[model samples]
Target: MSKSAIFTGLVIFIIIALFPFWINFGKTAPVPEPELVGKAKTAKKCVLDKMDMRANHMSLLDEWRDSVVRDANRIYTNTDGKEFAMSLSTGENSCLGCHEDKSKFCDKCHNYASVDPYCWECHTEPKEIK
Candidate 1:
């Protein structure tokens, strides 16, 4: 190949390789961290560790759903042997009690991750009073 053609190809390859880094060079803002909302903020602890919950919350919720709906089980026993009622109506012990504001807590991470969970389709979202 001609020197000029080789140089042009090299330049193009360099630009393509560095384009992504250059585009995001000065973006120092950390990823939006999920904020704990409602009673969760003040709660002693969660059923699972923070990292576990963040990574596997969907699977956990699915398991809970199946246990409650399919198996007709209404109690969840944690690793520590603490039993919690799996009924959605018992908000305090379930999801809504801790995550009182779905918009602030759940929506933040879900929206950031572009995940559209169909949770609200079947379950009623708690109306914010204020």
Candidate 2:
């Protein structure tokens, strides 16, 4: 090939290879690892750690209430601490909302996990599987 043609081809190849590097230059600064910047509160730590744990279905609801709903109630200062669904009359949000069947899903999973949920202490039902 002619020297001029070869040089032109080489320049094009170099530009094509380096184009990505230059185009991304302005926004390509390495994102530094997120700093553990602030002093996390003990409650926050507990909540975060609890988030990592695998909770049985029943315990999940209770944990959700304690870690999240209760915190929301505290922060929002709402009259109703229990954020039950509109159809729910007893406990905050019907168990059937997620588990479908208390005995079938909730009890089965909890029993398999060897967890006796304390949910019965505060809530009761008509023994009707809805």
Candidate 3:
């Protein structure tokens, strides 16, 4: 009887402790999907596969930074055997080259994920997010 009472008490305590959480469950904002526009759309290609990019973009960028700055390697070969400049410059083939509209293309998903990547600190936000 004591064991049963203790288990019941524990269960009640747990429910009470989590009641606030339960009340707000499933109330989060829906996941945001960033859309490509302008050059990003017409290119019909990305540095990696969509799923892979979505999961590992930060890792890929970190690797690119190290390679470009430390090793002076600026060529990135994608899994599809395509080569691209590992640059964040505003050239016609760089990161900002394609993703011209940071607000729509990058910020949507980044904001939804609550991340503030430092990419901007070095590369600078687009002068006009064009």
What's the CA error at residue 104 for candidate 2, in Å?
Answer: 0.8
Task: List clash counts for every candidate, in order.
Answer: 0, 1, 0
In model 2, where do residues sit more than 4 Å from their true spots?
Answer: 1-60, 63-93, 126-130
**lDDT, model 1, position 44:** 54
Quality of model 1 by C-alpha lDDT: 0.78
lDDT of 2 by residue, 58-90 (tens): 344555567545465422121435343322114
Native-structure RMSD, model 2: 18.2
Q: How big is the positional error of residue 76 in model 3, measured in Å on the Cα after superposition?
A: 1.1
TM-score ranking, high to low: 3, 1, 2
What is candidate 3's TM-score against the reference? 0.73
Which scores better on lDDT, 2 or 3? 3
Candidate that beats the other on TM-score, 2 or 3, i.e. the better one: 3
lDDT (Cα, 0-100) at 119 in candidate 2: 60
Indicate the residue-level lDDT of 49 in model 2: 36
Better of 1 and 2 by lDDT: 1
lDDT (tens digit, per residue) of candidate 1 on 53-111: 78997898889899878989888888878877675435678877776767777888788
Cα error, residue 53 of model 1, in Å, equals 0.9
Cα lDDT for residue 19, model 3?
97
Clashing pairs in 2: 84-93
